[model samples]
Target: MSVQSESVTDTGPEQTVGYTLHGNRYLNITNRCTLRCAFCPRFNDEWTVQEYPLRLRRDPSFEEIVLAVGNPEEYQEIVFCGLGEPTLRLYTLLEVATRLRPHARRIRINTDGLANFVYGRDVTPDMEGLIDALSISLNAQNAEIYNRHCRPKLPGSYEAMLDFVKVAREFVPDITLTAIDGLSGVNIPACKKIAQELGVKFRRRVLDVVG
Candidate 1:
C-alpha cells in the first residue's frame, strides 16, 4: 500500500518495478504471496530488500516492467523476485520473460514452489521456453519445519511444493533448491541432500542476504 524507492528509479510515484543487486536485475511484479514466512522482511514490518523499498501500491504493468529494465543485457541475470512470490503473477512473469529472452543473458524466478497448489494444475510447462532457471525456496527439510517457518495457507503445502519441483524439472533446465542456513531447525546439509535426491542444484542462503 505504501510506495517507496531509492535504489531504482520509482515509477510515477507508484512502485519500483525493477531493482539491481549483485549484477542481477530483479523484477518486483507483485506483492501478493502464497505463504507467510516468519523470516520475510515484509512480515516483520520491513519492506526493503538490499536498500530498495519493495512494498507496492499495485503490481506494475508489462510496459512499466520492461521500461524499468532499461536494457536486459546490462545485467548478469534477470530475476523475478521481490518482497513477494513472483509466481503469484504467473502470466505477467511469463510474458515479461518472453519479451526479455532474446536480449537477456538469463531469466530466473525466485519462488516458494506452490504454483501448482495455488492454480490447481501443472503450470510448469508454461515456463519451458521463457525461464532459464528456478530458485525454489525449500525452506526446511520436512513438513513440520516447513510449516513452522513458511506457514503456507493451504493444507499439504509442503508436499505440494515438492510435487511442483518434480514436475518442474522436466520443463525448466536449471532448478536449484534453496534454504536459509541460519534459520532455527533448518538443516542445511539435509536440505542439500533433498536437492541431490531430486537431482538438482542446492544453495545455502544467509539470513538477511537478498539475491
Candidate 2:
C-alpha cells in the first residue's frame, strides 16, 4: 500500500492525538537505529505514543519529508526527532534542514549521538550552521553502564557519543545532553559532569511508561 493510504487507514484516536503534526514540526528521518536503550519503549514495544503512532514500515525520502513539512513557515521549530536517530539520514536531514532554515526560526535535532560510529564518518560537520539546537541522549556516565542501558549496536559508541557532543558544541549554538531520571545504573551526577565537560547543557527527563 502507498504511504498516504497507510497513514489514512491507520488513523485512530491515539494515532491522531499524539502524532498530530503540531506547529512544532517533528521529522522522523529513519526507523533505523544503532542503539536499543533499555528504558526506550521503541526498543521492544509497538511504535505508538499518546495518540500518535511511531510505526514506520519504510523510511521517507527527502522530497517526501519536505512535502510532510508542507509550509515550513508555520512551525516555530522544525525538529528532527523520531523513534530512531535523525543523523542516520545525514544527507537527507541536511537537505531538509537547509530547505527549512530560511523559513523556520529554528531547526533542532534530537539524537542518540552515535552518528559518527554508525555512519563511519564525522556527522557533526554536516550539521554545522543547519542545526540551531542539538539535543543528544547521553544516558549514562561510564561506558560499561552506558552499553548496558543504551545497548548500542556499535562498539565504542558510548565514547563516540560523548565525542560527538563535544565536537557538536563547537558549531551548534545550543547543545543539550539528556538522560532519563529513573534508569538503573545511571549516574546522573556524572552524566551532568560530562555535559559540563563538553560545555553543553544537561537535562534529566522523566520516563513515562505507557500501558
Deviating ranges (above 4 Å) for candidate 1: 1-7
Global Cα lDDT for candidate 2 = 0.74
Q: Give one digit per residue, the lDDT tens place, for model 1 in 78-183.
A: 9998679889899988898889999999999999999999999999999998899999999999999999999999989999999999999999999999999888
Off by over 4 Å in 2: 1-23, 208-211
Best by lDDT: 1
lDDT of 2 by residue, 1-211 (tens): 2123322222232222112243466776666787887766686685754445666766777777777677767667777877677788888889988988888888888898888787777778777789999889888888998889888878888888888887887778999988887788888998899899877899986774221
Relative to the unseen true structure, what is the Cα RMSD of model 2? 4.7
Clashing pairs in 2: 14-51, 15-51, 18-51, 19-52
Per-candidate local distance difference test:
0.89, 0.74
lDDT of 1 at 123: 99
Write down the TM-score for model 1.
0.95
